[model samples]
Target chain A: MSSAPVHAPASNDVIATIRDKALWIRRRSFQMVYEAQLGHPGGDFSAADILATLFFGVLRYDPERPDDPGRDRFVMSKGHCTGAFYSVLAAAGFFSESELSTYMQPLSRLNGHPNRNYLAGVETNTGPLGHGLPVATGIAIAGQIDAAGFRTFVLTGDGELQEGSNWEAALTAGHRRLENLTLIIDRNRLQQGARTEETASLDPLDDKWRAFGWQVEVVDGHDHAQLLEVLSASPRGRGRPLCVIANTFKGKGVSFMHDNVAWHHGVPNKEQYEQAMAELV
Target chain B: MSAAVSVESGFFDCRDSFASTIEALAAADERIVTVVSDSVGSSKLNGFRSKFPERMVNVGIAEQTLVAVGAGLANGGKVPFVSAASCFITGRALEQVKADIVYTNVNVKLIGQSSGVAYGELGPTHHSIEDMAWLRLLNNLTLIVPADPWQTEHAIRAAAAIDGPVFVRVSRMPVPALEHAGAFEVGKAEVLFEGDDAAIIANGTMVHRALAAAKSLAGEGIRARVVNMATVNPLDEAAILSAARTGAIVTVEEHSVRGGLGGAVAEVVTAHDPVPMRIMGFPGFLPTGSAEWLMEHFGLTAAAIADAVRQTISRKR
Candidate 1:
C-alpha cells in the first residue's frame, strides 16, 4: 500500500499514511529476514520510518521511469540493512510486493546488498560501509553543474561514519555549496554488535558536519511529521548541503528488540517473529 | 645498458598525452568532467582546470572520495575521469574503486598517473607496480596500460568512448612515440614486430624497450617478436596464443614480475599452450634509485629483456 509521493508540510493524513507504510515496512522486512534467516533487522527497523517517509512522501520518482535523468535520488548508504530498503521500494512500486519472498534466494535480484544494475530503484551498489555519501556527493555535484532540479539524499548508518570516505565526500559537498543534496544520518546509536558510542564514538556529529560546511538539522527519526517537515523543506538559496541527524532506536518497532544491538544481524525465530509482528502495529 | 638508455624517436611522458587527450575530449563532449584529488599539477591538468574550471572537480587530496565522486558523476550522466597518483588511487582507495566504480559498473575513467616505479627515488610507498595485479582481478573494469604517448592518447579516447569503468595507467617516465598504421582497439594486442624464434610481450613504458630488445636480438641472429599488450583485464588471447606458438614467451613490463603484464601473458600461454616463459620486471619493494636507475637495477632494460628472450629460447621444446 503506497501513498502518492508528496512534498508538503506533513498533514495528519500524510503522517498516518507514512506511519502505516512504516509499520508495514517493519513487519514485512522482519518477515523477509525471518524467512531468509539472514539480514540486519536491527538496522532495517531503525531505518524503516525514514525509508517509508522518503519513498511514500518526500522522494519524487516514477517507478516506471526509474532511470529518468530528472528523478530525485535516494542512496541507501547503510546498504546491509536491505530488509527495510527492499520493502519501501516494493511498496513504492519499484517491484512487486511478492518478490520479497525471493529476497536473498538463489539468483534473486533482491540480494543481501542493493545493486543498481539488478534493482530498478537502487541508485548504486552498496554493501561495504562508508560508500554511499561520496557517491551521493558526486550525484549532487553533477546536478549542481547541470543546474538540474532533482535533489539527492543518502541515508547512512551512524557507525558507518567511522569510514573516512564519508568525511572526504562531506568536505567536497559542503565546499561546493551543493544545496540540492541532503545527508540523513540514521543516528540509531547501536551498530552491529555494540553501541556506536562504544564502538568508535560518533558524538558531536552535528558539529563535524557544520565544520565541513553543512547545515545541520536534528530530528526524531521515527516521527513521520519531523522527517517530512525537514526533508520536504526547500533547498532554494540555502547555499549549503543539509545534514539531518535522525535520532532513532536500533529496533524501533518491536518491544523486545528495541534499541538492542544483539538483534543487529540476527533473524527472528518463529515465536519471536509472531510476537514482533504483533508489536509492529 | 644503463639508466641513460633513451627512446629512439625522442622522449615523451605519457602523462602529457593523457592531459592533451582529455582536454580535446572535454572540448567536444560537454558531459566530460575531470575529478582529481588535489592532483591537478601532478596529473598535468592545469591547462584543463584553466579552460574548464567548473568541470574540473578537485576533491581535495582524498583518493577514496576522488574515485567515488567519479562514480557519482557518471551516475549523473557525466563521463568523469578520476585522476590521481597511481599508488594512492589504486591502493589507498581500492575498495571505492571496486565498489563505487567497478562493482557499481559506472562509466568512471580512472587515470592512474605515475604508475609502476615512476615515482623512482620516492620508494615503494609511492610505487604502483601492484596496480595491474590488483585491478586485473575486478571484472567489467577495462584495464589499459599505454606503452607510449600515442597509445596513451588512444587508450584515453577509447576509455572515454566506452560506457563502463576503465583504468588507464599513465606514466611520467619518458618513452618514445611508437609507429603504427592500424587503429587502436581496447582489447587487441598490437604486434610491433613479428618473429618465429621467440616473443616478448610488453606494455606501458616497457614497450619501447621491448622493441629495442627485439632489434638487438635480430642483430645477434635471434628474431624475437614484440607484442604491445596494453589491455590487461581482457588479455588479447588470440595474439598471446599466437605468440606462444613461438615455443618461448618472454613477458616484460614496467611492473611486478609476479602479477602484471608478464603474469597475465603467462596465464594464457600456460593454460592453452605451455611454453618456456621468463616473466621480467621488478621483484618487489626496490632500493632507492632514480626511475632510470631502478629500471636498470631491476634489469628492466633492453639488454636484460633480450638476454631473457635468448635464455627462454634455449628451453624451447
Candidate 2:
C-alpha cells in the first residue's frame, strides 16, 4: 500500500478541504481514463465527491483490515464508475496510487469492471445494474443475524433504478426493518444513451422509495458537508430502510463534461484533459 | 400400470425429497439457510420455512435478487440454498449466477426446481429446457441432475457437504426411485447395466429412460450398457471412454440437444476416442403439451432412445 497523502486544509475550511481532495481524485481518475482511452468518465466524475467523503470522513473502515467483520461495508452498484472507486481506494491507502495508471491496460487487475478476485476493498463485482442492492441487503441482514453493529451502504445510478431487482431488495429490506442498510442513489440524470427522463423517467423517485417503505432523504450529492450530515444521521423511521436520493450532475467537476450527455462515456482528448486538470487545480 | 420390480419404491416428486433432506441438514447445522423467490409452497419448502423461519428468506417474485442475495448470504458465512423455478432461476438470473456465485466462487447452492417441461400447462416461458446449457458454460459450478427421489436426497446432502458452489436441478415431475437404498456419490457415474455392443448414458429424468431402453435392446440379442451420469460438469471420463470403446454410445437428456448432457458426453467421447454416437434431446423449442407428451415428442421415451441407439450401432459396422 502507498502512504496516505498529507494536505493543507483549503480556504472554505471544512467543506473546501474535502472538496479539494475530491477534485484531486476526479482529476486523477480522468487522467487514467484518458490515458487508457476508455472508461465511463462521466459517472466517475459525478460520483467522486461522495466517494471521497465516504472513504475519508464517514465510512468506518480500516485500510489495513479490509476483511474485518465488524467494519461497515460499501457496494458500488454502478460499477462502471469504478474509476472513481479505484482512485478513492488508492487515496485511502488500499493500494499504490501509481497503479491507477494501469486502468484498462492489458492483463491489468483494473479491468472494465471491478473484480473482487484480483482486488481488495471491492465488496462484489457489479457491472450489470440492479445487482448491488440485493447484495447490500444481504450484508445488512448478515449483520442483523450475527448481532453485529456494522452498517451497509450501496451507491446506484438513477437510470439503473429501472432494473426491477433494486425494488425487490428495497421491499425486503424495509419489510425486514434492516435499519443498518442505507441506499445512496447518485441521481445523475444522464445515462449511457441519453438523459434518464428521455429514456425511462424515474421521477417521483423519492415518493416511490417512501412508498416502498424507506425513509427518504433528498440532498445535493456534491455538497460534502450535507452528504456527511445526511449519511451520519440515524435511520429516520422505525422499522424501515433509509434512501438518500442525492441529486447529482452527470459530470460534476469538469467544465466541458458537466451535465453533457456526450460525455457519458466519452474520453477527453489531450487538450480537453489538460483543461479539465487546470480547472481542478 | 403395475409397479416395476426394478423401481424400489412408489413414485414421488424429487422436490419433496430435496426439502426433507434440506430440513434435516438445516437442523444439524445452524449455518444452513434457504432462500426462495416466493416459491416456498411450490418447492415443497413450507415445512422448512415453518421449522426455521429465520433461515428462510422469501424474496417474493424476484429471481435476480434471490440469486444475488444468496451470494451475499454465502459471503456472510452462511451456506445458502437459493430455490426457484428452473426457468426463472437459471434464465432470469444468469448473470448473477455467473458473476456473484460462480465467478466469485461463493458457497451457494442453486436449487433449480421443476426443471425441463415440469410446468407443462404454463408453456415455453416456464419450461427450463436450456438451463443445463446455460449453467454448464459457467466455471467452478458443480451441475448435478438427480434421476429420482433417492438421488435427489443424496445430491442435496452431497451439495451441502461440499464447500463450494453447486447447482442441483430438482424435478416437480414424479419419478420412481431408481438408486438403491444407500448408494450415491457426487462425480461418480453408476454403471446400472453392463453390455459389450453399445452404451447408453443419461442424466436427470432420462436415466430411467436409458435403463428401459437397454432392457428393450436385450430382447433383440443387442446388449446395451447403461450408465447413470448425474454430474454433468465433471463428467465421468473413464466411464465415457469405456463406453466409447464399445464402438457406439448414446446420450439421453430432457434438455436441449446443444450444450447439455449429450453435448457434455460428446465432448468427452470425441476427445478420448471418437466413436459413432446418437444424441437424444429436444432439438429445438418444443410446443406446449403434457410433460409425458413432450418427453415422447422429443424422443426421450425408452423405445425411441433404444431405436436411436440401435441405429447408431448399425452405423458403426
Candidate 2 per-residue C-alpha lDDT over A170-214 given as tens digits, one digit per residue, 9 for 90 to 100: 988988888889999999999899989999999999999988888
Q: Give candidate 1's chain B TM-score.
A: 0.96
The sequence of per-residue lDDT tens digits that candidate 1 reaches over residues B1-317 is 01222344488878888888899999999999999898999999998999999999998989999998998998898999999999999999999999989998999999999998888999999999999999999979999998878888889999999999999999999887788748899999989987999999999989989999999999978999999898987888999999999999999888888888888887887789699999998999888889999999889899999999989999999
Q: Which lDDT values do the candidates have, in the order given? A: 0.91, 0.85
Best by the lDDT measure = 1
lDDT of 2 by residue, B1-317 (tens): 11112322466778888888998999999989999988999888888989999888887898888998898887677899999999999999999899878887888999999999888767889989999999988868999999987888888999999999999999877777774534778788898888989999998888888888998899999999998989887777888999998899999888888889888888887787699998888877778889988997777899999999889999895
TM-score of each: 0.97, 0.93
Q: Counting only residues 3 or more apart in sequence or on different chains, how many pairs clash (N, Cα, C under 3 Å) in candidate 2?
A: 0
Q: Supply candidate 2's per-residue lDDT for B196.
A: 89
* C-alpha DockQ for predicted model 1: 0.91
Supply the DockQ value of model 2: 0.56
Candidate 1 segments exceeding 4 Å error: A1-7, B1-9
Chain A TM-score of model 1 versus the true structure? 0.97
